[model samples]
Target: MEKLQVLDITGLSFTSLPLSIELLENLKSLCLDQCRLEDVTIIGKLKGLQFLSFLDSTIARLPKEIGGLTELRFLDLTGCTELKVIEPGMLGNLVNLEELYMENSFDQWEAEDKVPRSNASLAELKNMKNLSTLSIAIPHSVNLLRDLPFGKLNMHKIQIGEVWDCLCMHKESRTLELKLDSSYLLLEEWVQKCLQRAQDLHLGGLQDGNDSIHDLCIEDAEAEDGDEIDDDPKVKSCKLRRLTLRNLPMITSFYKRADYPVDLFDAQQLVFLVTSIIMNSVGYSPFAVNEATSLEAITIERCQLIRKVFDLEGLTTNEEVEILSRLRELTLSDLSSLEYIWNKNPQRASCFQNLRTLKVQNCENLRFLFSSSMAKALKQIKEIEIVSCDKMEEIINVQEEELEEAKSADTLNFPILTFLSLEELPNLRTFSYEKYDIHYPSLTRLTISSCPKMMTFSSSERKQQLMRADIGLQQAFGHINSGLSLPVFFNEKVLFPRLEELKLSSMCRLKRIWHNQLPEESFCKLTSFTVELCENLSHVFPSNSMDRLQSLNKIEVVGCPSLEALFEWVCLSSEKRQTPLVLSALKKIKLWNLPRLRDVLKSDRKVNFKSPCLMEVDVRCCHSLPYLFSSATARSLRKLAILEVSVAITYGA
Candidate 1:
């Protein structure tokens, strides 16, 4: 034990440490995090300990003997919820301590008799001149802040709760986060007086009744030298790069021109912003006209009253027209009252020119993703995902007037889009309500599930393009009738031209995979196709479609009770029948729980299976098939490995 330099007993179930740990005189690092230990007085006996952690443990108090560990440089007690006090002079002796973390480490510090009168003040931290990082909760009392060495210490990071006064005055702190238990009226005063060069600021649990964020600002007070504080009392506007606001329920509005002379959004250097559970803020559009030019990312979640995201009504300058041009990512989730991302605005000029990813989830009131004008401007968007939004009727909502105008306009293009996913949107009817032509030049992946009412990809008879070069749209769109009516075209266009993998599940109303005749090169580059729980689907592919699926490696169909045939041959002519359809790259086929399936292929025309790479055929719970494959086709499956079927079927070879 004397030779031990490091010992990690993390996540162990033991309740206490053995006294033998004291014999480890050479131990330099010890971790008992997430353990069941409650008392650790024996830890003090290791004079050579330099690092110690008891994170997420039940330890309640530190023994006075712990002060003897002068060599301790790092100590962590994060998530020690039962901790209430520290013995007097316990921290004063650890003069070499460099980092201390006590975040959420103690609760009920105000309860009667919860902490001993002799308990040491956090002022003991003042003696640890070398401490550079600290995360601890401060009591509500102002006395704790007076004796603390705020001006003398060079702290690089600070995460504190129950902020009183003067704590923000530490100019050397690079990051400061405040988690308030209650509203503090002097918040603006502290920000104006101190926090001049902080790079990151996080404010949580700030609730001043019925007052918006605009009202939080206070005029700069005159300094003791009789000189008025600088005109802009905010943290040096160019220094703060990231800001977060969480659980500020009473903040009715994020910004108001009449309430403040200067706004926090005016910080020109800000890059990342996050707001969660800040219920009453109406929208973030205010920032667009003010200071959103440098922002790279933003996240807003669970903010119930925010009905819109971007409002550009107040923008008047040409520079404001280019706001959010550099933003690359945006995420909105669990916002029940969010009705629109950008409300109808004929004058809106800002564009998401650099946005690459967008995600929206569980926003039930949002009837659509964005207006037609906004969709046309997302030139750089590469991925879009929408999930569980019940009221979404279409991804891009176009007005009746706009729909008329779109008929005479050229096609709108998503030049770089590669991935699109829509799941559980029960009311989704189309990708766009207007008949505007749209092209996805780079799209390679698409997923759609649980959307029973989705009848088509678009309501208008417009040209659609999926430009995957390996298997271009020319292969699939050749058979599509531009004049075909609503729901059928929806099912027909389900498969993109360049799609290599496809999955369709729980589409209750889906009747056909493709309604028109099969093109000569249809699904030529497809590798895998999967269909599950699609109750109304009767057949997967048209008769001649399988002939061009040269790259198809696997097909799986399950829980589709109404599926009757895998392929239904539409014999075009005797000339076409003379040359049997071939699947040269086919390898595996699995069909399960499809009771009505009568035949794998229901064609009188000859079908050829020339795949030397063909390996397995498994058919289970399908009661009506008399034979798995036709005689001529079975003879050509040279590489067949396993044929598992529910009923004995005649095999020609």
Candidate 2:
């Protein structure tokens, strides 16, 4: 190999060349960035080096013989902010050139006339058909592109959007973008539409009102009727898939009916659309109709509007409005006045039946979401989440007799529900089962947090006594016990056979999970469990029976101050081998904030068969846990963590 090429080297401390670096001749890229070299003018001797990246002011201006390398492809002069005025025809001989990247730091201070004219000859660029990409930071502001001397050039991608607007003039360019600030106005009629293949379109910082300077808004375009005029110079759909309208505080509305306007319903190929109308307090904007049949996802944010969204009048009945049949996801948020969204739910066959997931947040005035008849029609929904809505107290409410009859009928509905969450609602008191009752045996995740009074079974003893008197004593206890039983009864077998995750938080009076009966396979597939802040809960599980919980892989007990004696009771249990309390599948255990008496993993005498599968233990803020794993028999345990506890234990070998 010939000596490796070095295009340009400067600002380094080296006084002489390293003799070993002279063998690799084909090197085409080089940069000596911000080093401390002095008097390095031997660069012309490297004949094979092509690309050169040199600082402008730190290194002197290039020698007139700098065009010796005929194979130059790229040159970067970014850090030399003060360098200006290139000599005419400085790069005319570079016939194999492809790109030139320059960062013009002098643009802020230089006048438009004082900046150097293009020293490189025009014949070089026009003759090179292989040239694809060009990036330049112009030293002085000018209308750079309107009168460009080059003919039409074709390329697949061009990104020129972020350059300051005063640097480029308005022109019907290729696939390029023009970015303007909130106060900068480009004449709407002079707007140049570009690129027959342009697929993505974005407009930023365009403001509204007459005196504000931004007169070229979509709303300002001349309109005839509500329909957009087809003769206007608008991009009639190419291959566009994604369109985003964000942070435009301009005159309201997306499409001007008279000029540059077309219907999305007319575009039959549209798929995904995201729009934010935060400042638009407009009276109406009909975004989609039956023409947009291929739309799959739509998100509407901060559009504080009048109550109703879609009206079922002369167009189509609620049953006929199949506007988004292929739509799989929809999100609605921050519409404070949108209380009753679905008014035509009573007349429709089913709305949002194909919806798989729905998230509603911060909609305070949303009192009713789809009449009860509509929610019952959704069979394909798998997840529903509601959070931080102060006014949406009760989503589903039905009579108690209806719930009993539905349970007696043994329905196999709720075929797809696997996750449900209700959180941060302070006004919610009762969650009636009948209106929301669907058999979700496939549910693997359920979280209920921060709702204070979600009492499915009444906690009042006087009310229980009165109900018992009305029903007579014998049937009341039976009903109360059956009503409070958990693990869900399905034809006398447990329903949650696949459930692996359960969390309960902030429930102060929920003293028990099940009052009397137990499932034949309680927690049969339960792998992770967490229960917190149940201050009235005196026991973790039902008093004497834990026969069905053989599949527990991990358990976390936290924030219950009254249940501190639980571990001591477990340690003092009957040591008979036949009736031993064995958690064989349990591998991880954590206990936190239980401040009372506790002794865990203790053995007064040497044990034969230990708690075989307990491998890890974490104890935090438990003041009473004096010793853990004190037994000489350590079987499967490999790690233990303890925090804020005044206890120490010696595990014997």
Candidate 3:
């Protein structure tokens, strides 16, 4: 047994090491992974022991007798969660040790003069000339020196703080992280060098008292008399990709300037930042954001008290627009205190030209997402989704500071926007306020649900109350005087030229879907339309504008009790003839639970447009109907197949 060279035991249940097993005097490697041990001092007599590991063990203390193993080359105590103390002078006695690991374990390092004379001091590490690899946790930094020379090690992961993000463990070769309060004594020159050497580093709680990290950088920048950080930069913050701030309640933004207290990167880019407190803003940093050209996407979720994402207050230069220009997608969710996605100054323009998609949900305090100028910069925006934001009244808002200025630039155009969905926003009134004309020239699909307060898509020059649609949104036009806002969903100023699908539901105050005859370009390509639980709608389309739906393919309406007909003909004072409603491209139609519906079509004129493509028809519970369709319209239903109804299949055309 004295001649044993190696002994490895993994996941073995044991109370203590066999005292007789100490006979292995020449053991060069001894690994007891996941083995519980009460006393390991019995093996201390093995002076030639070169490697020892008690990985994931429950050992409480490493005895001073461990010093007897002076020839030890490696020691691993990783995952020894209960190990709080190591006898003073024991680690220093390992003069030949080459590697040491104590991470997630012993962190109770005592100062040289502390009463825990039983506990080891970090000073012992100063003399280990052969030590190249190290992993340690010093949860309390009061006992550590500001200059530990950790940068000299080839590979190291040093965590110093009370709490750490465990999800970041074991993912990097060299890392330095801390959740401790800002202490200058712990961030001295050697620590700065260590930060420069880290690969996946995190500097948490970098704030000082009431001051934020941006304040720190601004102060440092001012100290240099507004000069850029020193020219002789090898690496200031390149390797450190992540920064975390915890419990910093007063911070307004992150890294608004390039200058900071420490030298961190040579390649100027920050990948992601995670904060655990009330953050007032995001993307206020110009230097870091401008250098991160490859940053494509950002997702922030489960955060608390974030007021805005971008605060473009004093920024006017094209250089500042580099912040979010390269980002193609941005998603924010579960942020209860989020107020604005982009807080902008309309006079100063920044670019979001490459941002193609944006999604937000569960942000109850968010009232609006973009300012007018911000929307103008979204030239390539293709998709937007907002859900469950109770206070959101507008997707593009005209800030009070820029209201008068916005009037000069009257139109806000989304040139390539294709898909937009606004769901469960009960307080929403309009996409833009009552002034500027918002135009979606390329909009293809639109979905709005539970937005009972939406008076119109845009209220520019056309504002109407729910019951005032018959009195015209504006003064009477021409000889017809056909109240322009009779239907209140859309106005003339806002256009959906290529809209293919529109889904709406649960809109309690909606009495109409569209106003009087819109231009030929509005809703001209609509293919599918769906509505559910809208109690006040009397009809789907007004008879005068029915010819504009030449490309509609499918229609589904359900649970609207006050709905009277699919098409309702309202004659203007000069109109003596009714125009027939034609869904020429419609292939499928489903209607359900509309109790007051008397007819699918109410026009008295003979039908001129034939729906040669009608494939399926479904109707149910419409108690006041007479016949399915007029005899002339039924003759063209050659492709009709699936027909299901709760009441008789009867509807007057």
Q: Which candidate leads the pack in lDDT?
A: 3
Q: lDDT of all the models against the reference?
A: 0.63, 0.45, 0.68
Estimate the lDDT of model 2. Answer: 0.45
Candidate with the greatest TM-score versus the true structure: 1
Candidate 1, 1-653: lDDT as tens digits: 57999999877775557889999999999998988776778888999999999889877788888898999999988888777777777888899998887766653333223355567665577789887677666545333343354422334455566543233343434556566655442344444333433444455565445334442223433432232233334311223434444555444355444333322232211113222111112333343324424445555555555665664334343233454566777777777776777644334455677789999999899898877777888899999999999899789877665566665644667888888889999877678744566666577677888987665565554322211221242233233222222245333323345667777787765666665653334355778888888776778887657656778888899988878888865555777666766677779998988877887777665545455677998888887666677677778888999988875343342
TM-score, one value per model: 0.69, 0.51, 0.60
Question: How would the candidate models be sorted by TM-score, starting from the highest?
Answer: 1, 3, 2
Off by over 4 Å in 2: 1-387, 394-433, 439-448, 453-497, 513-523, 542-548, 562-578, 596-611, 620-653
Between candidates 1 and 2, the one scoring higher on lDDT is: 1
Candidate 2, residue 511: how far the Cα is off, in Å: 3.7
Candidate 3 matches the true fold with a TM-score of: 0.60
Candidate 1 global lDDT: 0.63
RMSD of 3: 9.7
The model with the greater lDDT, 1 or 3, is: 3
- List candidate 3 segments past 4 Å from native: 1-294, 316-321, 345-349, 407-409, 461-487, 570-582, 606-609, 648-653
Per residue, candidate 2 scores C-alpha lDDT tens digits across 203-260 of 3344343222222223333432232322323322222222222233332343223332
